[model samples]
Each structure stands twice: as structure tokens, then as C-alpha cells.
Target: MKALFISLCLSLLMILSSCEGRTGYLDEGQQNTVAMLTDVEWLVVYVDYSISNEQTFDDETNIYSFGRDTKGWTATGSLKDPSIKKDVRYFQWTFTTENYAVIYMAGNSTDGYWMIEKLTPDELWVVITASDPVLYPNQYKTYYKLKARKRQ
Candidate 1:
């Protein structure tokens, strides 16, 4: 029994040591991307997916705002759905190599994982692969394109 316990401990130690840690700084290009994304509040100009249709944000009627901070982000807007209430939430964002993910920071249940497709000062594009609860059994590879809101 003692020998078996020792073997188990050794095995656990090996497994733990093999796991990678999330400790790294963004490269120069990645830093630039992050800077641009955080520079201004973004309007959701287009969202195309199996779960949701494409939408354009106008000054009146339809409006969506998404922004990122140093450590977290916030988004608040309406989906133009009568049945669904307006969405407003805060989340923590982490950026990796050409990818980023958001985790709900306020106990809200929305999370997102996206791969960066195009990143520019004026335009930001990302691809999201997910499965919707409403459209279960069907996966969606969605594309979201957003343009920076004009600063007045």
C-alpha cells in the first residue's frame, strides 16, 4: 500500500509539471493590435452566423457598444429582438497568439472564444466557432466585423 501511494504521488507530480503556465508578454505586433482594439469603443457593424443574423448599428434604433479595458471589457446594447431583453455585461479578456477569449466577470453567463481574422485601426474582424442552445446540434462558425466609433 505504501509503495502504491508513492507511485501515485510521483505520477501526479509528473502530470502537474508537464502542464503549461500562462505567463508571457505579447509580442510587438500583438501589442499593437491590442492597443488599436482598446483605443476606441467599437460598434457591432456586422455579425453573420447560423445563430444570429447580420446586424448594422445605426445612431438610432439599433445600437451596440463593445469596449475593452486593461484587464476586462464591457458590452451593452440591444439585439433588436422583442422577446430578448437588452444585453449588458462585463467580462475579462485574455489575448494569446492571434486569438482572444472572454470570460464573464460579473457572474453573467456569456463567454466567447474568437480567432483574430483581421485587425486594423478602423476595422476589426474575428471568427467565432460555437454551438447555440437554441440551434442545438448545429455548430456555427460566425464572423464578426466591427468598426471603431468616431470620436467627437
Candidate 2:
């Protein structure tokens, strides 16, 4: 009876040890991505419109902020556009994939999806794509590549 009790206790201990508690609702990769995104204020450094072939290399004052709330994340930024002017825009953001490779933003001024091409502690590159035939007549799909870096 003593040997059996010891064996049972050891088995229980092994099982409990194998079951590790989750750090958060998000997986490790997603948590890392979120941490990287929220850790810095991103400043747009480059922009490229695929259809128009327009590339802007000039220093941009646009700053992007990603809130860290796992339940209701937000993406806010100020865009300096001649047509739109410099207005602070707000959008709810979320990762569409389990790998956290894509980000979707929806708001009045910005409504699109961005595929994260590269993400690092200091730099981020995303390919923005949107498709709205009714809103954007004659345009089937549009692609915009944006590169941003952490503000110094």
C-alpha cells in the first residue's frame, strides 16, 4: 500500500509539472509580436503604392501607436496627407492569423488589411491591401507597402 501511494503521488506530480500555465490568452509568438508592436512609437519611413508606382522616401511625420490591450487592441495614427490633411485616425486592430502575420484595421479613415512582411524591435514592414469595388469604382485591388521604424 505504501509503494502504491508513492507511485500515485509521483504520477500526479509528473502530470502537474507537464501542464504549464499559459502566460496569456495569446500564444508565445503572438505575445512577442504584440510586445514588439506596442513597445515603440512607429514612424513611417517609406511608402510605396504598387499601382501608381509612387515611392516616397522623404521623412514622414506620421506616427503610429498600437495599444497593448489583448481584448480590444487599437491602432491610432496621424497621417499627413494633402487630401486628408493631418488628422488623428483611430481603428480597432487585430491579428487575423494564428501566426500573427496579418493585421486588420477598420475605421472611418482607414479600412484595410496589412500583411506583416517583416517585424522587428526597431523596424516594421507591411504590405497593405484592400478591395472595395463599390467604394473605389474601377479599382479591383490596391497594394501599398509601408516601412516604419521606432522613433528615436
Candidate 3:
């Protein structure tokens, strides 16, 4: 009887300890860390996210500003020129290193969001998703992005 009781206790302890070791955890703090576009990287106009059906805009420019101490970042992307858009000047995207961001567009009908898909010292992929289409009100927008390595 003594041997049986001792064996039972040992087995229970092993089982509990093994279970504890198998649990998994997720840390949101390190999910999609990306470089701020305003401060670190220069904005290159390769793809435009603001071209709606009814708008006619012109040559645009953008600048970035990081939060006081990496708490977040803000982007002011503007639309100038009267050919592509009208009554539109600029938009702002506010973000954090947490990998998520929000862009408040300048035009009357433009607004959206974004996030970092991946980031590295050499290469990066920032995915941007937006809503409020000129023609398709029900459909949202999405942009998968890649950033080249900065020159030394």
C-alpha cells in the first residue's frame, strides 16, 4: 500500500510539471515593429493610396515626425496639383511602434489605416488597409508595402 501511494504522488507531480511547460504565450508589444516614415525613411512616390474616382490631384509630398520618445509617429502626406484631385490638401497618419496606425486623409472623402507586415534593417514590408472608396462605399482598401534599405 505504501509503494502504491508514493508512485501515485510522483506521477501527479510529473504530470503537473509537464503541463506547465507546454503552455504558449503571445506578446503584442513586439508584434510588427516598423521604422517611422517621417523621421527615418524618406518618402518615395511609387504607389499612391489616395486616387479615388471622383478626385483629381497633383504632385504630392509627405513628411514624418516621431513621438517624443518612440511612443508613436505622425505622417503628413499631402496632395497638391489640380489635375488628380480637388479641395484636398493633405492627410495625417498616426502610429506607434506597436505596428498599427491610422491615416486621416485631407480630402473630403478619404481616410484609412495601416500596419507593419514585417521589418528588418535591410528590408521591410508595411501593409496598409483603408476604407471609403469613391465608387465602392462598401469596399475597403489594402496596400502591401516594401521599403528598401537606407543608404549609409
Number of the predicted model whose lDDT against the real structure is largest: 2
Which structure is stronger by TM-score: 1 or 3?
Answer: 1
Q: On a 0 to 100 scale, what is the lDDT of residue 59 in model 3?
A: 40
lDDT of 1 at 130: 48
For model 2, how does the per-residue alpha-carbon lDDT over 1-152 read when each residue is reduced to its tens digit?
A: 99999999999999988986764477878879999887766656666665566554454445666778522222334334322224566767777776888777777566777778788887788766674333343543434334444433
| Stretches of model 2 off by over 4 angstroms after superposition | 1-24, 70-86, 131-152
Colliding residue pairs in candidate 2: none
lDDT of 3 by residue, 1-152 (tens): 99999999999989988785423432454333333343343232334344542322234533223332333322334433212322323344444332243333323233454445444543334434564233233544444333332322
Candidate 3 residue-wise lDDT at 17: 80
> Clashing residue pairs in candidate 1, if any?
none
Q: Cα RMSDs of all predictions?
A: 9.2, 7.0, 9.6
Please, what is the TM-score per model? 0.54, 0.61, 0.33
What global local distance difference test value does model 2 have? 0.63
Q: Judged by lDDT against the true structure, how good is candidate 3?
A: 0.39
Q: What TM-score number comes out for model 2? A: 0.61
Decide which is better by TM-score, 2 or 3.
2
